[model samples]
Target chain A: MAKKNAWWLWAAAILTYLFLYLPLVIVVVFSFNDSRLNAEWVGFTLDWYRKLFHNEKMLTAAGNSLMIGVVSSLASTVLGTLAGIALHKYKLRFLPFLVLTPIAIPELLMGVSLVIFFVIVNQLLGILELGLITIILSHIAFCVGFVAIVVRARMQGMDESLVEAARDLGATPFQAFRLVTLPVIMPGIIAGALMAFTLSIDDFVITFFTAGVGAATLPLEIYSMIKIAVTPEVNAVSSLLMLLTLVLIVIASRVSPSALRANG
Target chain B: MTLQQRIGKWVLSWPPLVYMVLFFLVPTLIMVVAAFRYPGDYGGLAPMYSVEDGKVVWDLTLENFQRLTEDALYFDLFIKSAGYALATTLACILMAYPLAWLIARSPKRYRDLMLLLVILPFWSNFLIRIYAWMIILGPQSAFTRAVNWLVTGLGFEPIQLLFTPFAVIVGMVYVHLPFMVLPLYANLEKHDMALLDAAQDLGANAWQRFWRVTWPLSLPGVFAGSALVFIPALGMFAIPDILGGTDSIMIGNLIKQQILDTRDWPFGSVLSIMLTGGVLLIAALGAAVARGGRKRG
Candidate 1:
C-alpha cells in the first residue's frame, strides 16, 4: 500500500515537472524551426540563431541590458553588503523593516513612483535624463533589498565569535572585518551579486517606466518585437536568455543554497 | 563603542538607507502628493508654478480622489484584478500542494535535485515564458492542434484556447506555481513524520492523520505561498496582456494604460495607491497567518 501511494506521488511529481519544463523545452525546440512561425515545425535549421546574432537592434538592446545588469548589480552588491553587515552587527532599530519595504511593495507601484519622482526631479533640476542612468538607478533601488536580505540571512548563520576572536588578536576593527568577516561572507556576497544580476536582467516593469524614448533593454526590445509580431528569432533569443539565467542560478546555488532559497 | 566605530558602522549602513530614502520613500511620498493634486493641463501632477503675466499660481486639488470614488469603472477593474489573482492563487495552491508534498517526501539523496528543478524555471525571463505559452496555445500549434483533433474526433467543435481568461490563468499559474511550491516544500520538508506515525498509532486513519497533523503544520507554507502568488498576480500586466483577450484588463494594465497610453498621472497614481493598499492588506493578513502558525507550532 505504501509503495502504491508513493508511486502515485511520484507520478504527480513527474507531471508537475513536465508542466514546468514544457514551455522551456518548446522554446528551445521551436527556436531552430525552419518556418517563420512556431505554429508548424517544418524542419530544424540555425537560421533564426544566425538572424538573432546579426540583428543590430537586438544586439544593441542586449548590450544595453548587459551593461545595466552589470552596473546595477555591482552597485547594489556594495550597498547591500554594507547594509547587511550593519543590520547583522548593529542595534539600529527600524532598519530591517525599512530595507524590506521595497520587496514588499509591488513592482508596479515602485515603477510608477520612480517615474513620477524622476519627472518631478527633472522638472526641478533639469539634470535628470530618463535613459540608462535612470534605468540603472531604478534597478539598483529594487535589487538592493534582495541582496541585503540574502546577505543578512547568510550572516545570521555565521558564528559571531569569529570576528570577536579577530578583535581579541589586537587587530583593528577594519582589519578584523577585512580579514575575518569579508572572507567569511564572500560566498554570501557572491550569491547576492548573482541574484542582483538576474533581477536586473529579468526586470521589465521598473525598466519599462524609467526607460525613455531612446533607451531599450533586451526585455523592452522583446516586448516591442512581440507586440509587432512573434517570430522564430524571439524563440532563439529567449532560449539563449533562459540558458544564461540557468547558468547564473547554478552559480548562485553553488555559492549558497540557503541564499538562493531566501531569494526565492 | 567608540565614536569612530559608531561612525564607521553608520558609514556602512548609510548608503543603502540613503538610497532607499531618496528613491523609494521620497518617490512614494511624491506619488501620494501627486495622487491628491490636480492633473496639470498636460498630463503629470499639477504644475506648482504657473506664469500668468509674471505671476506664479500653485494649484492643488482633491478632484482626483473625487473622480476615483465616483467612477464605478475603477472599482470594477479592481474587482476583476482581485478575481484574477484569486483564481490564479487557487490554481497554484491546488497544483503546488501535491508537487510540494511529493518533493518533501522524496528520498533524501534526490531531494536537493528535485528542489532545484522546481526553482530553476522561476529564474528565467518571465516575459519569454509567457511568450512561449502564446506559441503553445496558438491556434495552429501542435498542442492546440492535437486538442482540436481530439475534440473534433469526439464529435465536438474545436475550442479556442489561447488569448482567453483560461490562457491568462494558465500563464499566471505557470509563473507562480514555484512561488507556491517552494514555500510549501520548505515547510513540509522539515515536518516530523514521527507525528504521522503517532497519529496512526492513535487509531487515526490516513485522512484524519493528514488533517490533524500534516495540514495544520503546513499552514505557514500555505500562507507564504498565497502571499507570494497573490500579490504578484494582482499586479501582473504582461501575463494578461500577452495571453489575455481585450476583455481581460486587470488593474495593472489599467494603471499602465492611464500612465503610459493616456498620460494621466493623477488617475494612475490613485489606482497605484489603491493597488498598493490592497497588496499591503493581503500582506498583513498573510503575516497574521504566519504568526498564528508560529504560535501553534
Candidate 2:
C-alpha cells in the first residue's frame, strides 16, 4: 500500500526535474544543429563555434563582460566581508527587516531607480554616465546583499569560543581572525565572491540600463545581435556563454551553500 | 562593547552602508522627487526637470497618484501583473513541492548533486534561456508546429499560448521554480517521519496525515518559497517581454517603456513607486507569515 501511494509522488518528482532540464536540453541541441530552426534537428555542425571567433563585435562584448564580472565581484567581496562580520557579530536590532529589503525589491525597479539616480548624478556630478563605474556600483549593491546573507549564515553557525579562546591566548583580534575565524569562514567568503562574480556576468537588465552606448557587455551585445543579426553566430556565442555559466555555477556550488540552501 | 569595538563595528558596516546610501537610497529618494515633475500621469503639472527644459522647477502635487486612479491602462496592468504573480507562485508550489520532497528524502551524498543540478541552470544568463523559449514558441519552429498540429488536428483549437498571459505565467514559473523548491526542501528535511507514522497509527489516512501534520509543518517552507517567487515576480519585466507579445504587458514592462522607451520619467516614477508599494505589502505579509510560523512551530 505504501509503495503504491509513493508511486504518484515519484511521478511528480520526475516531471518537475524534467521541466527544469528540458529547456536547457533544447538550447544545447539546437546550438549544435546545422540549421537555425530551434526545435528541428536537421543535422549537427560546428559552424556556430567557428563563427564565434571571427565576430569582432562578439569578442569585444565578451571582454567587457569579463571586466565587469571581475571588478564588481572584487568590490562586492570586500564590502560583503566587512558587512557580514559586523552584522553577524553585532546583530543590530533596528534592521532585521531593512537588511533584507534589497533582496525583496524587484531587480527591474532597482535597475530603473539606479538609472534615475545616475542621471541625476550626471546632471550634478557630471561623471556618472554609463560605463565601468556605474555598472560596478550597481553590481555591488545587489551582490553585497547575497554575500552578506551567506557570510552571515556562516558566521552565525561558527563557534564563538574560538575567538574568545584566541583572545585569551594573547592573540590580537586581527590575529585571531586571520588565524582562526578567517579559515573557518573562508569557504563562505569565497562562495559569496563566486556568487557575486557570476551575478555580475549574468546580469542583463540592470547592466542594460546602467551600460550606456560606449560600453556594451556580452549579454547586451547578444541582445542587440539577436535583434539585428538573427544568425547562427549568436548561437555560437550562446554555447560559449553556456559553458561560462556552468563553470560559475560549479564554482558557486563548490564554495557556498547559498545555492544548496536555495535548492533544498 | 568597548569604544574601538563599537567604532570598528560601525566602521566595518560603513562600506556597504555608504554604498547603499549613495547608490541605492539616494537614487530611490531622487525617484520620489522625480515622481512629481513634468506634467506626468495626472496631466496637469508644470515641468519640473527635463533635458529640453534645462531647468528644475519646484512644485508639490498629488497629480501622479491621481493619474494612477484615472488610468485604466495602469490599473489593468497592476491587476494583470498581480494575477500573473499569483498564478506563477501557485504553479511553482505545485511543481516544487514534490521535487523538494524528493530532494529532502534523498541520501546526503546525492542530495547535493540534486541541488547542484537544480541551481546550475540559474547561473546561465536568464535572458538567453528565455530567448531559447522564443525560438521554441515562434512560428516555423519545430515544437510550435508540433503543438499546433496537436491542437488543430486533434479536435482542439490551436491555443495562442505564446505572446499570451499564459506564456507569462509559464515563464515566471520556470524562472522561479528553483527558488521555491530549495526552501521547501530545507523545511521538509527537518520534518520527522515518526510524526507521520504516529498520525497513521492514530487512525489517520494518508490524506488526513498530510493535512493535519505535514501541511502545517511545511508552512515555513511554503511561505519562504512563495515570497521568493512572488516578490521577484512582481518586478519582472523580462519574462513578459520575451514570451508575451505587445498585448500582454506587466507593470514592470509598463515602467520600462515609460522610462526607457517613452522617456516619461514622472509617470514612470509614479509606476515605480506603486510597484515598490506592492513589494512592501508582500514583504509585510511574508514577515507576518514567518513570525506566525515560528510561533506555531
Candidate 3:
C-alpha cells in the first residue's frame, strides 16, 4: 500500500527534474534549429552548426579552456594527491581536516588575494606572462583542497598492508608505490582530477583577476556577452558547452577500469 | 624513519605546503595587513616601505575604520545584502523541501537520473547560469512573454516578476535550489520511516507526526542547506547585478566597486573582511544550533 502511494512521489520527482533541465534541453535543441527564438518549434537546421564552426574566437576559447583545464587539473591532482598521501602517511601537527580547510575559504577572499599575489609576483618576476602560467597556477590553488579531501577519503579505507607487501617483494619505495599503492587509489585520483578539470573549466572569479587579455576564457567571453545583449550565438555556445560537461560527467561517474586495475 | 615513510613525508607534504604558504597564506596575511593600515599610507597604493619626517611612514592607519563608521552608504549596503540573503535562503528551503521529499520517496532506478539533472546546471559556469536568468527576464524575453500570455489568458494583470527584488530572489532561489535539495536528500534518504509510523500509531495526525518526528530529524539538513544558501547569497553581486536589473546593490557589488571603481582599497578591505567574518559567524551559529539539537535529543 505504501509502495503504491509512491506514485505521487514519482510524479513530483519527474516534474522537478523537468523544470530543472527543460530550459537546457530547449537551448540544446534550438542550437540545431533554424529559428532564433527557443519558444517556437523551428525546423531542424545546421546553420548554427556551420556558424559555430566558422567562429574562430569561440574555437580558440574552447582550445584555451581545454588546455587550461588539463594543465590545471594535472598540477592540482599531482599536488593534492601528494598532499593527501603525505597527510595520511606522516604524523602532521594538524589532522587531515585542518589541512583540508581551504575548501571552506570564501571564494571571494581566495580570488582577491590570488589576484594581488599575481600582481606582485608579476612585478617581481618581470618576465612572467599572465596567460597560461598564472591561470593554471591560480586554478591549482583553488582546486588542490577539494582534490586532497576526496583522495584523503579514499585513502582512509585503503589497507596499509598493500605497500608493505610490495616492499617485502623487493620493490623499491617508488616501485612499490607504482606497483602496489598507486593502482589501488587511482580511482580517487581520477575522480579528483576530473573534478579539478570541471572546476577549472567553470572558474571565472579567480581567472578574471589573474588571466590576461590574450588568455580570456570562454567564461570571460560569456561574461562580456551577458553584459551586452546575450544573443542567440552565446546561447548556441552555451548549449555546446553544457553538452561537453554532461558527457564528461557521465564518463567520470562510470569510474573507469584504469582506476583499480591500473599499474600502481 | 622507514624508507617508505621518509619518501612519503617529504614528497607528499612539502610541495603543497610551500605552494599554499607562498600563494594563499602569504596573500591573505598581506590583505589582513592592508586592511589594518591607514589610508594614504602605502605611498598612494604603490610600494613604499620607508620612513618620513621622523614619523614611521607605514600604510597602516585607522582611517579605514573611521570611514566605515561614517559611511552610511556602506552600512545600508551590508544590511540590504543580509536581508536579501535571508529571503533567498528561505525561498530555497520552501522550494527544496517538497522536491527533496518527493525525490527521496521515488523509485531507486529514477533517483540518480533526477539528481544528475540538478547537478548538471551546477557544473555550468555560475556566472553564465545567472546570465541565463537575465536573458529570460530581460524585456521582451521568452519568460516575460510567457507570463504576459498566461496573465492575459487567465484574465489577470501581468505579474511583475522581473528586474526587481522579486527577480533577484527568484534567480537566487533557482540558482541555489540544488544546494538545499542535495543536503536535504542526503538527510531524507537516511530518515527512518518507522519513526513516522510510530507517531501514526500513537494517534498523531500527518501534520503532528511531521512536527514531532520528521521535522526534528531533518533539521541537520535544513541547517546545512540554509547555511550553504545564505553565506554565499550574502556575498553575491553577479546575480543581483544581472537579475535585480537596477537599483539592487549587494555587499559584493559594494566591495567590487570599492576596489575596481572607487579605488578605496582600505575601505574595500574592511568590507571584504566584514563579509569573511559574517560567513564565519553564521557557520559557527549553524554548528551551535546543530550541536544544541543533538544535546537536547
DockQ by candidate, in order: 0.66, 0.58, 0.42
lDDT of 3 by residue, B1-297 (tens): 878567668777888888877767777776666677644544214543567887776555677777878969778888888999999998787778877887687778776766666766777767657766665666556778888899889999877665688788877887788889989988988887877788888899978987888888999999999998998788877777677756787888777666656656667777888898888899999999999988987
User: Residue pairs in steric clash, candidate 2?
Assistant: A263-B182, A264-B182
Sort the candidates on TM-score, descending order. 1, 2, 3
Tell me the tens digit of each residue's lDDT in model 2 across B166-241.
7788788888888998889889989988898888889999889888998899998999889999989988998897
Q: Which residue runs of candidate 2 sit more than 4 Å off their true CA positions? A: A1-5, A93-99, A228-231, A252-264, B39-57
Regions of candidate 3 where Cα sits further than 4 Å from its true position: A1-12, A33-43, A90-99, A124-130, A168-172, A256-264, B1-4, B38-48, B53-56, B107-110, B149-160
- TM-score computed on alpha carbons, candidate 2: 0.92
Evaluate residue B140 in candidate 3 and report its C-alpha lDDT on the 0 to 100 scale: 58
Best by DockQ: 1
- Give a tens-digit lDDT track for model 1, residues B83-121: 999999998888888889887877777777888788888
Poorest stretch of ten by lDDT in candidate 1 chain A = A1-10
Q: TM-score of the second chain in each model?
A: 0.93, 0.90, 0.89
Tens digit of per-residue lDDT, candidate 3, span A131-208? 768888888888888778667767886898887888888888889888878888888888889888988998877777
Instruction: Please state the Cα-based DockQ of model 1 relative to the true two-chain complex.
Output: 0.66
Across A46-122, the per-residue lDDT of candidate 1 in tens digits comes to: 99999999999999999999999999999999998988888887987766766778887778889988988998899
Better of 2 and 3 by lDDT: 2
Q: What's the lDDT for residue A102 in model 1?
A: 87
lDDT of 1 at B158: 94
- TM-score versus the correct structure, for each prediction: 0.95, 0.92, 0.90
